[model samples]
Target: MAVHKLLDDLYEHSYSLIAIHSPLKDYRLAYFLNHQLSLKLKRTKDDFSYIENTSFSTFHYNDDTTDTAWHLITNISKNVVNETRDTDLFGIKSTTVLHYLVPEYKKVDYFLKIDNGDFFYQLNAVLKIINEMTHVVTAYTVDPNQLKSKNNLIFLSNA
Candidate 1:
């Protein structure tokens, strides 16, 4: 892809990312982002509207769906800040993030929650493993249920 074309393509479809829908893709976002969100990325007709979500940290991705949502959400937060010059584009207020983890998280700061049902309960082992990997200040998970018209800062925590 030409430099301009690639930048143009990234602009339109940049904000929305194709996350690791399953444990299989978390460690390799390029494959899934390229394969999964291909159509969305095509909407950009040019201009620096979007940049690829490449927030590489010491925290490398691993094939663990346990807290994959949390890691991805944190990545989104850092990505927005780094990519958008740290501007709060949507003018968000309080953000509430909901994620499903089998064992649930402890002493978490920022907006976050673990579902009180089987989704998390079933994946208990995975949740424990993922939780062991992180110890940071982050707002993770956006509840699809709260996605009501614009009041979705909390909902966007997942995005």
Candidate 2:
């Protein structure tokens, strides 16, 4: 499917559902923090922390709450510069429900509606990061343990 189509499909879904499918593993989370977002992941036995330059923060995602990270990444992908009225389902300025899945960042309306070309450009930049993170996460695990969770993937943001 085209990236735009893929993104629209993703945006309509629940982040909680996506993360349970293996997108929120320790390795993948670490990769996203350290590489994709240019943040540092530090484990201290009891918690996971992410740091970017001087902005240091910590996050936790057991089987219950980990899917949130995927939600943000997924929803952010919906930012299309030239989306028609049909694709603008979330309103002109909306904070993705994905961010609500994750607790680190304050919920704010932050996605910018852009054109197809700009949308693809932004998606391409992040896709590289997501792809790399995916590779790192996929290489080590044959069966992802998180997928066993039976929680419903629901969008809990400004939906």
The true-versus-predicted C-alpha distance at residue 86 of model 2, in Å, is 60
Writing each residue's lDDT as its tens digit, candidate 1 over 18-60 gives 1122333233433333243221111112212123543222112
Model 1 misplaced stretches (Cα beyond 4 Å): 1-121, 134-143, 149-159
Q: Count of backbone clashes for each model?
A: 3, 7
Span of ten consecutive residues with least summed lDDT in model 2: 108-117
Instruction: Assess the local accuracy of residue 154 in candidate 2 as a C-alpha lDDT between 0 and 100.
Output: 32
The deviation in Å at residue 84 for candidate 2 is: 58
Each model's C-alpha lDDT?
A: 0.28, 0.30
Q: How far off is residue 94 in model 1, in Å?
A: 25
Q: Candidate 2, after superposition: displacement of residue 60 in Å?
A: 9.3
Candidate 2, residue 78: CA error in Å?
30
Candidate 2 local lDDT, 1-159, one digit each (tens): 655434323443222221212335444555554565554434423321121211112232222222223222221112223333545666454332222222322231111111121233244454445446543332211111143221112322321
